[model samples]
Structure formats: C-alpha cells, structure tokens
Target: MAGALLSTPNRVSLERLVQVAKERGYTAQGEMFSVADMAKLAQETLGCQAELLCGGLGGPNRDGVLQHLITGHPLLIPYDEDFNHEPCQKKGHKAHWAVSAGVLIGVQNVPSPGYIEDSELPGLFHPVPGAPHQPPSFPEESSPGAIFLLSKQGKSWHYQLWDYSQVRDSNLQLTDFSPARAADGRVYVVPAGGVKAGLCGQALLLSPQEGSHQLGLGHLPQLNPAH
Candidate 1:
C-alpha cells in the first residue's frame, strides 16, 4: 500500500487531494473529509473502492469502530446533532478523517480548542487523548463511528470492518502504548490474539513527535505483538 501511494501517479493525486482540501477552508496541518471527500480519496486518489461503514448511532459499536482504525483501516467520522449549544444546536454535522499512524488519531480541518466543552468533541475526536478545552467551532455529538477499510479480493477491491464482536470474540486486547519502534523510531501496538490464528492486527502506534501531517505511509512500522 505504501509503495502504491508513493508511485508517481498516486503521489500526484495525493498532492491534488491536499490542494483541494486547502481550497475548502481547510488548513495545511489538518483537514476534514466529508463522505464524498473520503470517496474521492479512496477511489480517485488512492484507486481503491471505498465504503462508509457505520457502527450505527452512538455507543454500542464504539470499540469495534475504533479497533478498525487502530488496525490500519481508514475511516471518516461525522459529528452528529449531539454536538451543539442550546437552542441553536443540531444545526449541522462535521466530520474528520481517522488516520492510523501506527496509532489511530483524528485530524480536524479547524483549529484546536481552548477549553473543554462538556460535549464529546475533545473526548472522541482529538488526536491525543484528554481534553484541551472546547473546540473553537467543532462541538460534536457522540458519534456512531464511521470508517473505511480497503482490501483486494480476486480481481477487484473490497472495504470491510471487524464484525463488531471479533475483537472481544477473538480475545484480542489493545496495548495502547507498545514498546516496539518503527524504522523511524515511532512505536505502535498490535493485538496479541485474534479471532483466528495468524490474523494481522494493525500496529497502533504513537502519533508523530513533531509535525503537522501524521497520517502518511512514510513509515510502515513493524508490528510487535502485546504478548
């Protein structure tokens, strides 16, 4: 996948995608991708068939949806009406891309917040865990969790996710901070057990130490099992 991304054509397309994002009021640091934008990145930019898999509305599949992203699946989560201040709430939904840079992180098109809102914005969407404060503009609701996964089956491509219970069913546990390091010295975590033997869990790693873009395939870190 990394090789394909660096290929001249795909690299050019990725640059174009970034340019389009910049034109849409997004910043060079991070950007939001609507369902349509995600589709474009998958099909037109990445050249893969993309699907928007939702875990339904709120809570239930939260862990599963998160696991998908943690394991290298690409996803885009849209904020729901649950985000908003009184009276004028529920007016709109905003979304951001879920990037798996060894570890899963959410990238926003808007700026970071100054204070924490009692809402779900900082809790669920921010790249790093913990509340920095309420976002300047993104007050999102508890998301149902939406993600995109790509796989090549036979002659074409397919997008899929864990069957919601596979993580627990497989007895897979997440090691938030794995000790193994990537070629770039970045660390990531991988599941020790899987629903089936020999399953390759996505190596969830730490975010970049410094940088604006953290979702690139520049470093495909080696996976280190928790066990």
Candidate 2:
C-alpha cells in the first residue's frame, strides 16, 4: 500500500491524487486538475489519449492541431505502424505538442520509478521496416520526441488517479483490470487477468530526474536462449 496505493477521492473538491503527485513530483495536464494541484506534466502529458479514458481538454480548436494522436488507445498513439508523417487532420491523430517527453510505462502491480518529463532522454524510438525488431531511435536533445506514459484509462496513469478519481468518484470504472507492473523495474504489463479483473497497484522506484529507466518485457531470456 506504500507504493502506488489506491487514489483517494476528492469528496470536498480536493484531489488527494493530485496532491500526492505534486508532493512526490508530477503534475496533471488536464483541465480537471489545476496547476496548484498538479505534478510533472507541465502542459498535457504526452498528448496521447488513454483507451476509453481521455486526457487534455479536447475541443474543436485543440484537436485541430494534432488530432491524429488521439487514437482512443494510448499505446497506439506512438504509432510505429504508420511511419508516413504527411501531417493531416486524421480522426485519431492529435497534434504532438513541442515539449520534452519520456516513455513512462506503468506495470499494473509492481514497484517501479516515478515518471517525470524532461528535455533529454533515452531517445525517440519508432518502429522500422525490414527490421521490425530494430526500432529507429530519433535523438531529442532539446526536447523529448515522445512522452510514453502508461495508463489503464482516462484516469489510470498515476496510482492516485484511480484511488482518487475512478474508484472514489465512480465516474469511470473499467470492467477490465490490467496494466500489470512488471518486476523488471520497467515495462508495465496488463496481464489478461488484470484486464479482466483489476490492477492491484503500481510500484514507485525513487528517482531524482525523469527518463531514468527504460522498459523491458523481462520474458526474453526464455524466448531468446542465446543470451
């Protein structure tokens, strides 16, 4: 319960999740939470939409810029499958706001580090052709190319998001539980059981800076005995 505990509800218009994030070092980007009640996310976190859960105030003006990023599914927003960036008004696409970002994968029920946005990074990785295994790394010196954070739904990224909003508010409840936090210290895994049931919680690896670690599936030793 010490790590990513359940988010407490804001029965009195006070989001304990937001408070905890701010105290720990993270800020929410959505309109629902204010700057005073925010953590790491200076603007909007990643500009990506979590499956059924939506983030960043969407409107005719907002979506017009980067509408393609809003794929309804959070993971799809990274979108390595569609490498051609012609830049158009796609239904799911949302404008990639120019802000330094980092990949933040949250394992549903394990201990891990907290995600903080930064200008540097592990580098931008886009899937490549002919070598789907070797992902292309785009250097982001001044700004992080992508902010890959993990979440279950509209309010599922931070542990507090669920404890405070979902379960507490009861506004958005996911019938499926998922996003299993892996033991590798990275790569949040939403096991089928988690998707069907619900996540226990996430672990918090203490770190001073953002983009501190990268996610690994932790099941490759068996898959690739060569190692």
Candidate 3:
C-alpha cells in the first residue's frame, strides 16, 4: 500500500509483492511480515529507498515525523493499536501500520482542550468535549500541527487526522517488538526468544528511487508561521 502510493507509474500488484517476499525469503510460511521485510519488499517491488528512523527511548518523535513529511516523503509508522487513542472494537497487542501523507501546522481555534479540528481530513478530533480549548505546543519554530494518515481497514483505506502529541505519545507507548540492527547498520525486526523488545518508537521514511515517480506537494498543506 505504501509502496504503491510513493512509487511512480510502475506499481506492483499485491499478489506479485507477496510472491517476491516469499521468493526472497523475506517472510516464511504463516508468519507476520516484519518491518525489515516490508522495507526490503518496497525496495525490490516499488524501487524505493527505505531509511529507518528511530526515536530515543520513545520511538519516533513528532519533529522527526514532521521533518520527513515536510520533504513530501511518506513514512511507514508502526504502533500499538491500543495506544493509538482511537475507538477499537477489538484490541490488544495489535501492531498496525500507517502511511503518513501530509501535515497541518498551526491549527487555530481548537474546539476542545487537547483536541484540534481536522478540516482537510475526515473526522473531527474531539477527544474532550466542553473543556476549555488549549493551544497545542510544538517545536520552537513550529505551530500546533496534525498529521494526515492513510490507514487500511479490511479492504478499504481511510484518511485520518492524528494530533501530533497523541502520535508522539502513542509511538512512545508502543510495546510491540524491537528492531535489531544488522552488521550493515540496517534495522530488522526478528522476533526471537530472550530478545528484549517492546516500547519501540520508529518510522521508515520511503524515498523514491532515482527516475521514479514522486508525490506532488502542491495539494499538501505546509507549516505556516504563527502570527
């Protein structure tokens, strides 16, 4: 899904992607695909360069995610479903994947405390109702912002607007597994017994290979300087 969004005209089919993963031994019989496996598949199938970005102690930070999105590059973020702060019918240690498309900075007139409105994306953020509205804090030069996510549910894809702080906290609270760094400095999630894992906040930045198609930034919103 991510590869198809970032890649150009030459998009690989889902069946073909699975075939390639199996052929390259990226996945075994009846096993969940690891982050590294997905990255490798993106490279081979979509012709993208995947760079793993990790956060200290906490997984990926808001600034790091914003930086990557600012460059018009989509990111593959993995987080625990329970920590995502969204209403879920059934949830546990559900490790899920989401692709970030854009970001909106300096949200004005928050409807409620700790919540911001998402005019561009579907669904309004109203975590707290009737509470006094408080402005969201961001980096020194950045204003309050929200991230745009393209998430998959069953066979359909949905666009969501997630608060920056919520994203940061959820990522920090992710207790799914850990990614192991290879000798070449590449990180891969290899689930093994006795291996310390969990509380991993990481994201994979997908860059298009040379001569590949790129997503245009004209339609995406940018950070506007606060008045």
C-alpha TM-scores of all predictions: 0.27, 0.17, 0.58
Candidates in descending TM-score order: 3, 1, 2
Instruction: List candidate 1 stretches off by more than 4 Å.
Output: 1-9, 12-15, 18-37, 55-57, 80-90, 93-227
For all candidates in order, the CA lDDT equals 0.31, 0.22, 0.50
Clashing pairs in 3: 59-201, 60-201
Winner by lDDT: 3
Most TM-score-accurate candidate: 3
User: 1 or 2, which is superior by TM-score?
Assistant: 1
Kindly give the stretch of ten consecutive residues in candidate 2 with the minimal lDDT sum: 218-227
TM-score of 1: 0.27
Lowest summed lDDT over 10 consecutive residues: which window, candidate 3?
A: 218-227
Error of 2 at 82 (Å): 25
Error of 3 at 135 (Å): 20
Measured on C-alpha atoms, candidate 1 has an lDDT of 0.31
